[model samples]
Target: MVFLHARGITRTVELPDAEPLHILRGVDLDVEVGDHVSIMGRSGSGKSTLLNILGLLDAPTSGTLEFDGVPLDRMTAGRRDRTRGRNVGFVFQQFNLLPRRTALENVEMPLLYDGGRGFWRRRRLAAEMLERVGLGERMAQMPERLSGGEQQRVAIARALVRSPRLILADEPTGALDVETGATIMTLLDQIATQAGAALITITHDPHVAARAQRVFRLSDGVLHAEEPILEPAA
Candidate 1:
């Protein structure tokens, strides 16, 4: 399935006294179900901008984006919000878990907005997801109580608890040490693959980008595909 499609996606922002800033220009991307793709870029290269647009958190200034073949340009705001909420998941560089909430409670937050299950059912699903991420024993721990990697796992569990068809991760491992980052990435990819969800990662780390099957470089508001660096056979 074509989980996400974008063509001629452009984003422009205007400062009060300046010309419009073109953060993204004519960018096109396609992601299929269970595909792992990564975008690598320098700071201020608009990688995060593109991610926000793709995740439906922000609308493009021009061009079209479609999710599961449904054109975002044609949907009303309410419909778009519901569609985004149900089909898209996001993980950020900083673990975005609520500081006061336990790992399980944080994972359950999405279900509260979804209203797809009863309170007890939501708790069960969140618990199962936390367990899947190897944080089963830490479910009651607060974000501050967990290590950085453990906190990220909690974030991942929260992102996947709803089983979104598309997962957008922006600098997901940026806060971790080299070894921890690799472990987190591996765990993230494994879970996404098991869920059959398309994963799009935006990162400045080439090593992290190399983990994806397809890699692209975002430069000066444009995205260009780079040859994938394949791993040797075992």
Candidate 2:
């Protein structure tokens, strides 16, 4: 099934009574379950804008977006908001953790947003997610107390707390050192695959693109389809 399908999607940002700035140009793409895709491009190539549109965080200026074969163009704002939280998980470049909150609290935040169940209910699920990312012992630690990789682990736990169908990660490894980045990517692939969720990652690094099943290059506000990579050359 196509978890995401975009057809001739385009976006143009208009300033105060000025000509519009064209940010996206008739981009079409599709993703399926069990697929891991990496979107790569230079800055100002509209990589992040495209990611936002794909994740349903924003609507295209024009064109159709279908999720699970249902047209999203007609979906109401409230419905779109709920759909995004329920089906799409996001991991940002910055940890974006709550500094004062413990790792467990941060992880459980998503469930709370979705109106999750009783105290024990959320706690059990949060604990399970933390453990899955090897953060069992860091649950009670505050964000500042955790290392870079550990902080990102908490972020991933938070992303998966409500069990989303797709994971959108933009520069998830940007802030970490090489060693930590590798570990984080390893865990990201393992958890997303285990949960049967499609992963769409946007990174500027060639090596990062090499990690995905397929890598698409976007340039001049256009996305070009690409063949699958059997494996990255050693």
TM-score of each: 0.96, 0.93
Number of the predicted model whose lDDT against the real structure is largest: 1
Give the clash total for candidate 1: 0
The local distance difference test score of each candidate is 0.89, 0.87
Candidate 1: minimum summed lDDT over ten consecutive residues — where?
Answer: 112-121
Write the residue-wise lDDT of candidate 2 on 118-229 in tens digits: 3448888999999999989989999988998899999999988888899999999999987788789989999888899999999986667778988898977788866654
Model 2 residue pairs with clashes:
none
